[model samples]
Target: MTIFTANPHLLSTLAPFICFIVTVICLLTSIKIMRRYRHKQVFIILICGLGTAAIPQLLNAYAASSLQAVPESLYIISTIAGTISFIIINFVFMKMYAIGIRIRIAPILLLSLGAAIAIAASFLLAPYEIGGTKALGFPVLDFYMFILIITMLVVTRHIEMPAAYFISLCVMFSYQIALMLHQYVFEHSQPWLGALVMALPVLYYFLLFYLLLEWIMERLLTTYQSAILDGLTGLYVRRHFQKKLAEMIARKPAAVIFCDIDNFKSLNDTKGHHAADQALQQVASILRDEVAPHGIAGRYGGEELLGAIEIDKVKPQTIAERIRARVEQETIVTVSVGFCTTKESAELASLVKLADEAMYYSKSTGKNKVTSYRSIPAAYKNKA
Candidate 1:
């Protein structure tokens, strides 16, 4: 037999532990969706958590069962891996799964001190004897402390999450804590303890399962929003605006207002493209804030914004005036606005034409002015 396989019972001893480790890895693999993703940090931390639990168990088993037969190098590597994993879990918990930590010396010092103590206790301390069986017992204590510290962190965070997330966490935490209690306090080294200990990894797996679904849904929503939103102005793109405008036309006495930046192309030429883009973004912001309460607003191509508001709540002229005034005040740019209100049913194309004609009237008559569709000159209407 080969040196590594000399012990016939190694498979018997390692199979269950290896299976639990596999379960942990499977949790990670299942959640790994390349296109639809969220919280990469959490995925990494979970891998750390798995190693923190699994590596120590595997090494401790080898050390206790075949201390004389196993190479000393294997034992040393286990000690290093386990000690680092233990320290990482504590530090990670304190940071609350965030990339950055607050400026607090106490948490750092506390982590350093705990890591030092755990490393020393695991490597230097004597094995615990129970029922005439010799065992390196430091890992059990270290992991129990891990559960306690993370639980404290959870409480401090007030478990603030969606109802689904909160319930999943609570259920998993309850199962894990109960299993730890059973394994450590009531029956150490029991065959049943080994089976039940698998529960901890499984419970955590379920928590991650729920979290994976949540992450996917959030990603899909974010992607959908991006698809519909204009990149520069944070307004709905033309496609989405067309849909919303059609709906508004069918649903109510809707008004459409079109506003165009005065001499926008000249501004782009004089002030540069960067300044022009900034001006457009600023104008879109004013339109969004002013028009959102009553209706929807979106970019209708460059240097122009469109609002679809139900005229009963507020007139399109009033909404257009607010937007024009705000743009003049908040930005260096001014806009010419033309609006049309309809108390009766009107086709979307016709409404847009009326609003556009009025806006062109303002563009031709005066640079910064508000014009209504009804006020457009007869010649302008005929031309339109």
Candidate 2:
């Protein structure tokens, strides 16, 4: 066989092999991701795209490298289809991963559609006349690839994901741009230069997929963390704090304080819920400012708050009084506090009860007072 007869098919064969390897890697990675992270949306899209990718790669290989007869139309269709499919998969993957984060979906759709159109136009508008490159057979695939990169970058900026995904995408797009530049610079004398340059995008894509998966996992973890934090006060909520206290009990020392508003019902009835809410915010801020240095403060419920302080020697009454005084000075709305501590107590509910008793004791004496279980007068409790 002449060198010419053997050569034209070589590019086709190698392209399929490269694509197959990428497909298999993606398939295995998808399975691992589903098993490990259980990201059903991402896994399905990737798997479907990877599968679609395999058929084109195989067809391209057979048409180029093997003696088997295949239609040129099939090769062109596969190549275009593969590119479009991959771009769509990536766009959807990003949107799925950025659940809470806001993104502009309309642009992403337009960009991906533009890529599909560019690929279709390349084949449909090819020059019918002989030796005509400019009239209709102009190369438009590069433009599509460039636009795809730009759209992906724009989409990612709006979504909150790990830095690695962005970095990987940057690398992928940069490599594509460099490849395009390399082709433009050395189009003749080395046609294989184009293929080599193009190889970079494929290679970078493999890296990009893994980085995207990691970004999804990181985003999930961050979302979970946010769910446990109180939005208004920047503190762990009652449920989260209760869980933490349970864990702390199995380990070491802790203290608990429960606070309630003095005549808070009357305050809400008089000032409206909005003003009451503002007062609640003020109380939270004061507690955070005064007690958070030594502990954590959270709004337990309406007009009631709680604090957990870790102390080796400081008494619970001291922590309670510090918070009470600061809260009184911070707001026109006054609060009563009750506190209890035990280095060995594991049940937070027990401490909460003790603190509640002390708080009621303060209410009985007067509004805007801090009382501790240790300081409660026995006769004062009997009246209530």
Candidate 3:
């Protein structure tokens, strides 16, 4: 204890306080994220791991050189427990990525318990005297540490995550390895050296907690986006069209183009569902290629697509004609387009309905032609 206080190493005395703050912060942050994200259980396991490592480090720090005569056996047992906890936590983290969240609690607890037992038994019962069997001294410690590093790297590579987490993990492991090698070969056992060791994992916990927050945020954004997109065509769905229409009405200068694949049902019946799906996808691709840059093209319904674009000086019919021409040139399948501009109707839904009517007119007059409702007779428009 006197040696630790007198030691010049800044890492020694500072380690416990640093560990305490980091562990508490990580615990609070993880709990907060779990509540906000509602992706619990896995995060709970992670927090437990951080707790296991942090609590023992604190205990070891206070008891290491005190007159209470902390048994070496206690240190060994605590280290074993902490190591087992870490292994279980990492395994749980790994499981989440592979299989997704667990719905059943029993199987999850069963697996976690089994993993913890196996890891603990390996340290407590093994005969080889793996990595040295004391605090960060076991050869198995190195093996497990190496495995954890590799596992973390592998997990990071596959999962979408922030750069901060991987960088922190790299620093944490690098220091651990350095400390282990220093202890094993140099015979340097200064208690202060343990401060840096404890701090490293705490840093890892903080970074991981932040990464989890980011992960949850990203998932929320993705869900929001998917809600508005058509699953089949990867284009805007009808829901998105209504939103775009509202914007167009506010701006008062946009084109609405309605499109329908010619004889799509017949084609589907002749070619079978798979080919029809491929044809639909191909048509969607062409539509996206032609209109997506200038406007938003979305699958409105089966065999129907809608697009809207900002129109400055040019007529909406011109925009619609261009899209129709591109679809004809790009794919064997042709689409009939009907367009109306905001000058004709300010209401978004009315404009889209007008466009749909015009498209139907094109189908009636002839297939694969672009038409507008401006010139068509009211009776013909009514029929359309």
Leading candidate by TM-score = 3
Model 2 / residue 141 / CA error / Å: 1.5
TM-score of each: 0.60, 0.68, 0.74
Which lDDT tens digits does candidate 2 get at residues 127-241? 2221332211125776567667787789679787656567656765775566454434443235565455445545655665676557657767878868877776666788987
Model 1, 103-196: lDDT tens per residue?
A: 3446535654665566567556654333343323344445545564566447546533445545544554554555555434653445455444
lDDT of 3 by residue, 258-287 (tens): 889898898888888887787778878777
Q: Which ten residues in a row have the lowest lDDT in candidate 3?
A: 1-10
Task: Give each prediction's root-mean-square deviation over alpha carbons.
Answer: 8.9, 6.6, 5.7
Q: Clashing pairs in model 2?
A: 9-64
Q: Which candidate leads the pack in lDDT?
A: 3
Clashing pairs in 3: 130-139, 131-137, 131-138, 131-139, 131-140, 132-138, 132-139
Lowest summed lDDT across 10 adjacent residues in model 2 is found at 129-138
